[model samples]
Target: MGQFKVIVVGAGPVGLVLAIALQKSGIDFVVVEQRKQVPPPTAFGIFLWPHILRIFHQLGLYEDMQSIGQVMTKLENRSSTGEHLEISNSFELLEFAHGYPTMLFDRRTFAEVLMKNLKRSDQLVKTNKKVTNITTRKDGVTVDFADGTSERGSIVVGADGVWSTVRDFMRERAPPGLFSEGPNPFIAPYQGLFFRVPRPESLKPGQTVYVHQPNKQLMALVTATEAHMTTYERVPDVSERTYFSPNKVTDEDVKYWFDVPVNEQITFKDLWDDKVMGGKVNHDEGVIPWWHWDRLVLVGDSVHKVECSMSPFRGAGARCGIEGVISLVNKLNRTLNSNPDPSRQDLSRAFTAYQVEREPAARLWVHVSRLDIDLYTSKAGPASKAATFADGRTIPIVANSPVLDILPFPDEKEGVVPWRRHPKADGQSKDVKARL
Candidate 1:
């Protein structure tokens, strides 16, 4: 019953950030979320990279996030026996290299900040309105919700996450050979269990630590209120079976993975039993083949999902989603401006442009993330021994080198995305806006 230029189909970090960006660009948009209410607290924390930090700064969220999020100043990797494999003064290098220290913030706090910033005169986010279908017409697109309500918009952005409904719609309408020809490209082979608990005394607040094993890994990070942990063990039978669907995983099912040494004094099970806050849940990983089709496009986990580091943020879900929208918004600014009465073909071209810009970076990250996982879980091998070197000295300098610049080659700016041209490119330059 309402008209808008852009309809964002998710209220996660990416969708909310897109709404904020569109509003700042003076574009009319609305966000739809399936959840009826705010979800329960998660044992998830984010370790934002430099380019991620720079975008936060662009959006005027840097300082506010700094206040709520802790500045992560060091990087240390250790063995299950508490032996340091590689340790470095990461804060100085991060700050000197990117002008921003890596940040550690609980997912709840980060999401709250984004939600608060989007609060305005108009209700931009409509919850419990699960999008069931998206139909494209000559005029634009129509999105129908499960509740029997509908809205019309010039475009629909499927920020609905890794298992995206909009993505399904796009695939159904995809031209021959448009995407890959195979099993779910978006869901990776690895599955993980995670939860948050009261911060343990052994782990310093704001610090992230990973204890490695060749077959499995135990990862932890501490925030002001809670500590988060996760495990990524190899599953040999994954190729034949589908572990992509939601599993009502119990602690006992994953007890073997977390029953390891955190230090000399405490065991992971002790923490799990004493103070765990959320149920242990399993999520899939992998980069998808396609991002957009005609009036519909995907962002965040919907397009690409990877295990970048041992932790949740390691998947880099937050940053990927935010960057995806910024790219889309930028392309839209040009396409919509040039053709006020844009055709379906015109919108398709615009969608293709967005995918072209974001796909390379996202694909590269997932590829390298496969390597990151190999290193973190290596018990013994050339790659494992090399990555396990002290300060990574014995290994090829590449191990210690800047990843954003090197491994994910062809990055616009090495190590950091120092500046974002979208908000300004969209002609909303009073203050260039973007976000997480």
Candidate 2:
């Protein structure tokens, strides 16, 4: 059997999680990041559902995650004027059904836990190693970094977020008309600003609050020590919505959002004054039709960039990305276990299976996420009435969670919402064989 080393790009939560999954699978892998450090101490709060927690349980990181993560129980919806709209304990009910609570915590803390659990993290993860280009050969693939170093691996996984250099490299090698939106495809209809502050006395831990107003929306997830907050506002001009690079929040934007009322107790200004760390962001949304070609594949925001927890989807974007990792790793484990020295055809079969399972799922969530943004930002919707949660639409999606195929399924309690085992993981599925 030939040496099989997977090259993983980016070191965010999804990337780190991918590394750990690869490690647990007994697969050789390396992770490279453009940043100076592994967990760069950025990003706001994120929510993880039971589907992902199942995988974490198998990986032995669930206990650590529970230690740091706040088990979110209830969601409170309110108007800009502090009027109570509707309160839903759907999350608590989901916990009862799935045996795992929906967890909310700082993104950096999540990254830290993922990195800490990797036994060979020091040797496997490389920092400040930006990918400049890629070359695919008949035998394997080679990744070129900005630092003028290079690494050869059996396959490359792009966990890089939106504006992924690996995705750009794939575009360069793809045939004409492969990418629908040309080079930069993501649409930035809404602008986002987020930060973390000490949990307000009025707000208790484990409470997720949403304040809805016309063309503006605010979401705050209160953890033990802090409340991670995020706000989204529609960009007045459609042309300015397409972002190619990082765009900082202007002083005017900050001032405008600061004055916006969040219930009657406090305004954004109060949160801004107490912020520990915060920044502006362009909320880009898109799902590419194809996610892999030859020896290169993509994951996370690199392929499908969806709305965050600020939307009704509750960070379905990240959750979906994590599932993509599991799906991809599961296929790779099967292929390598069957034939360690897999031909390009064998590898392509695995990649095709991975994309086939994930692409449609990503497209669906992206569409739903867009609808969520429209509901709140449109004058006829949230401006007039309180936004409602679509439990029927979201619950089914969560119930059908996938786990690792090579490992034994952890014994877990199933709630009212049944957890459907992934068909592909079972030997019954012919999707991969048909593709081959």
For residues 285-356, what per-residue lDDT tens digits would candidate 2 score against the true structure?
778878888889999988988853355345777888999999898898779767777888999899999988
Q: Write the per-residue lDDT of candidate 1 for residues 214-314, one digit (tens) a residue.
A: 76777777777677777677665242224322234567766764556776667777777765554443345566666777778888877887544445324
lDDT of 1 at 324: 74
Reference-based TM-score, model 1: 0.83
How many residue pairs in model 2 have overlapping backbones? 1
Model 1: clashing residue pairs? 162-301, 188-285, 214-378, 214-379
Clash pairs detected, candidate 2: 97-415
State how far residue 215 of model 1 sits from its true place (Å).
1.4
Question: Which run of 10 residues does model 1 get worst, by summed lDDT?
Answer: 399-408
